[model samples]
Target: MNVLSLRNVTKTYQNHTAVNNISFDVPQGSIFGLLGPNGAGKTSLIRMITMITGVDQGEITLNGKRLNPDMILDIGYLPEERGLYKKMKVGEQLMYLAQLRGLTKQDAKRDIKEWLEKFEASTWWNKNIEELSKGMQQKIQFIATVIHKPKLLILDEPFTGLDPLNTNLIKEEIFKLNENGASIIFSTHRMEQVEEICKDIVLINNGELMLEGEMNAVKQKFKENKYSIEFDGMLPAHLKSDSFSVVEDTQKGLVIQVKPGHDSNEFLQSLIQEGIHINSFQEILPSLNDIFIKNVNNKI
Candidate 1:
């Protein structure tokens, strides 16, 4: 089930097109990655989805209904730009935001306290936003965003100011939210994070949709049939067939590229026959960063 769908969505500003005719679906109860380099229209698309901006053409739907102001109540958005009122007390600010999201005063207080405690931020509840560090403010913002238990959560560069420890904490919370039926749209320039958490992704480049699919399927589609081999002895010349070539050779291992029509099993046997005592051999899969660069560079 898709929690959100964009159909031929296009957004333009004067002579420039921020988001072209791109369409994608965000699956329900899953961590979905919205990825691209800077100026790739990702922010424009997100703004439209959050109702911070409107589309010039095409349609966007949330849970089968047309997106509008009312739907914003069902969505929790944490933008890359921090928007906390600097002088406001953390606890009071969170309570206000939660109330605006339709939570009762009592309910909001309970939820805010629970989230603050979970983040180990209870001690800073009385501190003004400006007094806290950037990472601390980020944690408070995140707590406020989800305090109302929104069904759809959109996070853009959510881990920007967080250290490794805090980043992991938020990541665990994201997974927990998905488990509890919240559909998340996680936007980031960090491909490794997407690989670790997202089941599906939509990548954009220059306002165009470059790719969209399950993470594993996209990786498989772009696979090059390369393998990394580590061995004690040097590879024999006879084992190097016309269909196989060493893309890289180092003290650690050899990165071998297997051409089309080459048999992996036959390649392995040849190496064994040559008396090469293989320590390890494993297929090399392209990372999301690799694919992102390849696609974007190719398009450019």
Candidate 2:
């Protein structure tokens, strides 16, 4: 089921188009990646979804209904740029944001305490936001965003300023939220996280959609029929065949690109004929980072 859908969405400035005739669907209870390079209209689209900016053309639907101001309560957003009252105490600031999201005082306090403890952040409650380090302040802001438990969570560069330990802590919570029925839209330059956490993705560049599909499907669609081989014997300097080409030599193995209409068995036979004792051979699948670079460059 789709929790959010955008149809022919476009956003424009006086003389510039920030988002141009784009469309995509985000499945409910799934972690979806919204990815692109800088100035790729990702931020513009996010602003429109969160109601910070209005769409110039087309429609956005949330939960099968046209989007409106009241629907803001159904979304929890953590922008790339952090915003919190520097002088406000951590607990006070969180409670205020929760209230704005329509949570009652008692429920807000319960959820805040639970989240603070879950993050190992209970001691930070009384400290003013200005007194905390950037990473510490990030924890407070994260707690505030989800305290009301909205159905849709949009996080942009959420791991900035976080150490690996804290990053893992937050990552675990993100999974837990999705498992419990929240849909997520994650935006980041960190391709590894997208590969690790997202079930599907939408890629954009230069105000246009570049790609969209399930994560595994996207990688499979771009597979190059390459293989990596580890052998016991030394590799010949100029190994070549009409059926295959040595793409590169690694520290422990050779990467081969199988020619069209040539199967792995034929490639392996060629290697064995040359006295290369193969220890291991595996098909190489393209990484998400590699695909991202390849597609963006091709579009350019």
Candidate 3:
């Protein structure tokens, strides 16, 4: 079932439409990527989902019901702009935020302690937010965001200030949360990270829905039938055929594009007939980064 659904949702400001007739579903327990280029209305859509702003047209639902103010407690949002109070102590800040999300004082304290220990941040509890580094502060904010154990998490540029170690730490926690029945909407410009973690994705551009589907399926839809073939010997200098064209010469292989009417098998058979010792042959699918660029440029 979908944990969140937007149907022809739109938001506008005077003469400008920030989100125009957008719609998509975020499945329960799935890591979904909400991606778009800057000025593409991603922030506007996020604000509507989080109830920070209302949609100008259409509907949004949570768990099959019309979205209401009460549903806000069920969502844990880590906005791209950090919102921690610099003068506040980490432990107290977390306790406060957790309580606001409907946790009891005692429950908040217990969960806070457990989370701090889990993040290897027990010693940081007593430190003021200003005393920690940017990365350290992010950890504190992350704990606060999840302390109430909300069912839906919306994280925007979550790894911005993190180091490699801390980035992995946060990533592992994200996976753990999704495994424990949380639905995540990960919004970011980092296509590589989305490629690694997201199973489904939706792309928006110029305030309109540009693409949406399972990650692998979307890549398959954009594939250009490019293949990489690794062989033991050098390619024939005069290698020529209407069935395929070599695009590049790699260290141990040549990247070739199979002609529209031909398949990989036909090309492989042609190479075999040419006496080339083949090591490996595989299709090279377009990366999410490449797809993102192409779609935003309206090349899809």
Candidate 4:
């Protein structure tokens, strides 16, 4: 079941359409990527989803019901722009945020303590937000966001100020949350991170939906039948074929694109017939980064 659904949703600002008839579903318990280039209306869409702003057209639903203010407590949002009071103590800040999300004082205190300790941030409770580094402050904000144990999490550029260690630390937590039945909408410009974590994705450009699907399925949809073959000896300097084209010849391997309607097995057999001892052969699917660039550029 989809935890969140947007149907023909659109938002406009001062005669400019920021989100134009966009629609997508975020499945329950899935790590979904919400990707778009800058000025492509990602922020506008997020604002609508989080109820920070209302859609000018269409509908948004949570758990099959029309979205309402009561549903806001069920969503945990970590905006790209972090919001934390610099003068506030970390513990007090978290408690305040959690209470606002409908948690009881005692429950908020307990959850806050557990999350801080889990993030190895027990010592941060007494520290003012300004006393922490950017990464440290992010951890505090993360705790506040999740302290109420919301079912849907919208994280935008969540790793921005984090180091490698802290990045992985938060990544592990994200996975844990999803595994424990939370649905996540991860938004970022980092395609590599999306590739590693998201199972499904949607890309938007010029305020329109450009691409959407399961990650592997989307890659297959954009694949050009390219294959990478690793062989024991050097490729024949005069190698030529009408069935395929060599796109790259390097020390690591030979990357070839099979001509349309040509079978990959036929290409492999032809290489073997030419006396090349093939060690490994695998299709090189287009990366999300490659697909993102191609689609966005095409729209432009």
What is the lDDT of every predicted structure here? 0.91, 0.92, 0.92, 0.91
lDDT over C-alpha atoms for residue 177 of model 4: 92
Clashing residue pair totals per candidate (backbone < 3 A): 0, 0, 0, 0
- Roughly what TM-score does model 4 have, to 2 decimal places? 0.96
Residue lDDT tens for model 1, 140-252: 88998888788999999999979999999999998899899999999999999999989999999999999999999999899998999898877777667788889999789
Q: Please give the distance, in angstroms, between residue 118's alpha carbon in candidate 1 and its true position after superposition.
A: 1.2
TM-score for each model: 0.95, 0.93, 0.96, 0.96
lDDT of candidate 4 over 1-300, digit per residue (tens)? 999999999898999999999989999889999999999999899999999999899999999999999899899999987879889999888888999989999998888889988988888888888988988988888887787788999999999989999999999999999999999999999999999999999999989999898999999999999999898877676566678899998788889999998879988777788888889999999999999999999989
Give the worst 10-residue stretch by lDDT in candidate 2. Answer: 234-243
lDDT of 3 by residue, 216-276 (tens): 9999999999999899877676557788898998887889998999899987777798888
Worst lDDT 10-window in candidate 1 = 233-242
What's the CA RMSD for each of the models?
A: 1.6, 2.1, 1.6, 1.5
Which regions of candidate 2 fall more than 4 Å away from where they truly are?
234-239, 269-277
Q: For residue 187, what is the lDDT in candidate 4?
A: 96
lDDT of 2 by residue, 2-56 (tens): 9999999999999999999999999988899999999999999999999999999
